[model samples]
Target: MKKTLMRPVGLPESASHPVATPLMPSVVYASDTPDALDAQYEGRVAGYTYAREGHPNADVLARRIDALEGAEGGIVTGSGMAAVTAALMGLLRAGDHVLGGDQLYGRSLRLMRDDLPRLGIATSLADPTDVDAVAAALRPETRMVLIEVVSNPTLRIADLDGIAALCAERGILLAVDNTFTTPAAIRPMERGADIVIQSVTKLLAGHSDVTLGWVAARSPEDRKRMYDFAVTTGMTASPFDCWLAERGLMTFGLRFAQAQATAERLAARLADMPGVRRVLYPTREDHPDRARAQAVLRGQGGNMLSFEIEGGRAAANAFAAGAAGVAFAPTLGDVGTTLSHPASSSHRGLTSEARAAIGVTEGFFRVSVGLEDADALAATFEAGLAAARGA
Candidate 1:
């Protein structure tokens, strides 16, 4: 049997008179040799071994995400929930305490609310808009404070640096999900975030075709523990998805820029239209976090913009159904503009009271700005609103 990797070129080579393996110069892609392993990585030898622990594709995606987020290193997971959950599981213990943002993705809210408690991990919710609320929720046992860079559905920006400073001073870790902002608009680590997580499912992949997630950190040491735990847990992402993620990142800067430009235009138009009761976008003048959004955001506020229709759920649904040029869909960050009702889609996992607490109402509609022609998308919404008003 050939060894996966043999050190010193002949360490105990009991391959006495065995078939000579062709000598190849040291190169990374040693996978051609069936026995080769990723030994060079762990100071063993130079070869490729397991795909789950390390694959060329996974490494490529990790490098791209790190480059995009400007992190020291990164780890990719099967889904967004896995990325966040892995970070927590790797960093926290049974007695650890967590402070969650008030405007959280509902599925994440459930994880904090139910799953963590059963593990003896305690969690408390805080208003991300209020620095005081975040600071007050911290406990001596607090291990990490997690928030979304831009709150979903509502599009509210969090005061990241302020909260990051508090975490740094208190010796706690701060993790931000940059899925909505997509690094091109806001690199949380640049503002003192300890970790930046991404759901490559949305914009990074640029298409709704792939589902993947990642956890990025500023230092290899910060990533070491998580990577170590990930291998044994058996929750690894597939190579195909990793390849799609890497390919998706190459065009991210361009896609993000284009989507954002159209989003700002849409937000401005929606804010002034009749039968539109509210436009919840970070850069809007009336947004509570407008000042912070301007301060930390690197580009036009990201591609998502949510608005409340005048009539209610029926009007919102009617408007969505009437949209022609733009696809009426539940997902975001695609090449074509897509629309959905957050109250029934993304935030549906939350109860009525919980949903209301986060400003998700029956009349709310969220559009993920895509690379579509802005005028065409605008006309589609215009026609929908006209139909809605008449109804």
Candidate 2:
């Protein structure tokens, strides 16, 4: 597995071949005959015609991810949001209903709540942690159930296996956003998810320098439909981003392991801090979904966690102002430890009441632990907490 993910495919193994796969930025391919070009377009031959429609670099990246996720096929997208939009729009019709986790990424919720309704698609938000709640929210018109394996900001772990079983029984499509726990931690397809969504801009890209997304479908029919939608809608990723993401995937397991270790240490220390009103991490014994996380994520709580300060937004802002080393970044899964205020950032689109319903408090601060020394990060956090208390 390591060898395949780290090494580039579709290239020769000879010494003449470059150690790294060279980028093919060709927008169009040449053909000896019109019939050859027609064959390529008709899927009779393997080649590239246009960069937007399809490219060698993107194809290689998608195949690698498909193998990693144990999916029948996969495709790359311009960005994470594009992947999400394509998955929903391609799969559902006007009258179809969707049951989505209430604690999803704020922008995703906005898309479903605001845009989906305009298209005549109905959406229902429910607590994914409660299997019964999710089951109850399902209707005869429901077409899909979307949930994140580990929710953003709050780090809530849903029962992927249980949900999969329910969806299988109900004949509903199960789509999992595996961004938080990449294939390195969990393969949603193996857990019976019909579709697996990945924000390659996150851990899969590792450096935060690349913007890309991928969708893996368990069925070939779904893959073809999604690919057709992507081609028609022009939701394509640049070859450079695809190449960079492939490079990042080489060291993904290593990076994820280190970051996860630091996160575990920080979660433990944060729980004991008097300035913290609550710490929400899946691996924590007090976590609402600890058992589920253990079963699905194999005891890895992931590298992201959230904690609420004793004071509300005031303390969170003060900590952000006082923190050292950690920057206030809007995105996570970078190599450096970073902080995010969900109440004002990722979950800002949701109303205050809506945010509260999912445990996103005013004082809540989510941190993406990086590959830094755990002790140093703890010291920096301690100083920031002191400043928050003082403020």
Which candidate gets the maximum lDDT versus the true structure? 2
Model 2 misplaced stretches (Cα beyond 4 Å):
1-15
| Residue 48 local lDDT, model 1 | 48
For model 2, residues 32-58, the per-residue Cα lDDT tens digits are 799999998888988777788888888
> How many clashing residue pairs appear in each of the predictions shown?
6, 0
lDDT of 1 by residue, 240-283 (tens): 87776667777888998888888888888877778888898877
| TM-score leader | 2
Span of 10 residues, lowest total lDDT, candidate 2: 1-10
Clashing residue pairs, backbone N/CA/C < 3 A, model 1? 37-47, 37-48, 38-47, 38-48, 38-49, 40-45
Q: After superposition, how far is residue 279 of candidate 1 from its true place, in Å?
A: 1.1
Query: What's the lDDT of the predicted structure labeled candidate 2?
Result: 0.87
